[model samples]
Target: MLSWVVTFLIIALIAGVLGFGGIAGASVEIAKAIFFIAVILFLVSAVVGLVRGRSNI
Candidate 1:
């Protein structure tokens, strides 16, 4: 999932360089959304792990 953010970022950069304003803007927005979702999922997983008494967490 995090890799998707990197992929979108690369696409945005390339699109911007190639003068594709709309594609670049949309890719950037998608990347930002994916990043936030990944962070939220990580936090939720950590909390769940802790609640389950997992020392590795």
Candidate 2:
């Protein structure tokens, strides 16, 4: 998921350099959304793991 966000970011940069304003904007937005989603999922998983570990003790 994080890799995808990075991929899109690179694509956006390239597109912007190539003078594709619309494509670059859309790609950037997509990258941002994916990055946030990945971060949220990571946090949720970490919390779940910590809670489960405590319960096991």
Candidate 3:
């Protein structure tokens, strides 16, 4: 997921350099959304793991 975000960011940079304004804007937005989603999922998973580990003790 994080890799995908990075890929999109790179694509946006390339598109912008190539003078593709619309494509660059869209790709940047997609990258931001994916990055946030990945962060949220990571935090959720970490919290779940901590809760489960505590229960086992």
Candidate 4:
């Protein structure tokens, strides 16, 4: 999921450099959304791990 954010960010950068405003804007929005989702998932997983007392983590 984080990888997807990175991929979209790279696409946004490339599109912006090529002057494709619409694609760049859409990619940036997608990247932001994916990044937030990844962060939320990570936080939820961490909370779950701590609550369950997973030593491996």
On residues 1-57, what C-alpha lDDT tens digit does candidate 2 reach at each position? 989999999999999999999999999999999999999999999999988786534
Model 2: residues with Cα > 4 Å off, grouped in runs: 54-57
Candidates' C-alpha lDDT: 0.97, 0.95, 0.95, 0.94
> Which portions of model 1 show Cα errors greater than 4 Å?
55-57
What is the Cα-based TM-score of model 2? 0.90
Instruction: Pick the lDDT winner.
Output: 1
lDDT of 3 by residue, 1-57 (tens): 989998999999999999999999999999999999999999999999988786534
A best-first ranking of the candidates according to their lDDT comes to: 1, 2, 3, 4
Clashes of 2: 0
Ten contiguous residues with the weakest lDDT in model 4: 48-57
Q: What tens-digit string does per-residue lDDT give for candidate 1 at 1-57?
A: 999999999999999999999999999999999999999999999999889884655
* Model 4 Cα RMSD, 1 decimal: 2.7
Candidate 3: where is the Cα deviation over 4 Å? 54-57
Cα lDDT for residue 8, candidate 3: 99
Give per-residue CA lDDT, model 4, range 1-57, as digits (tens).
888999999999999999999999999999999999889999999999889894755
Show the lowest summed lDDT stretch of 10 residues, model 1: 48-57
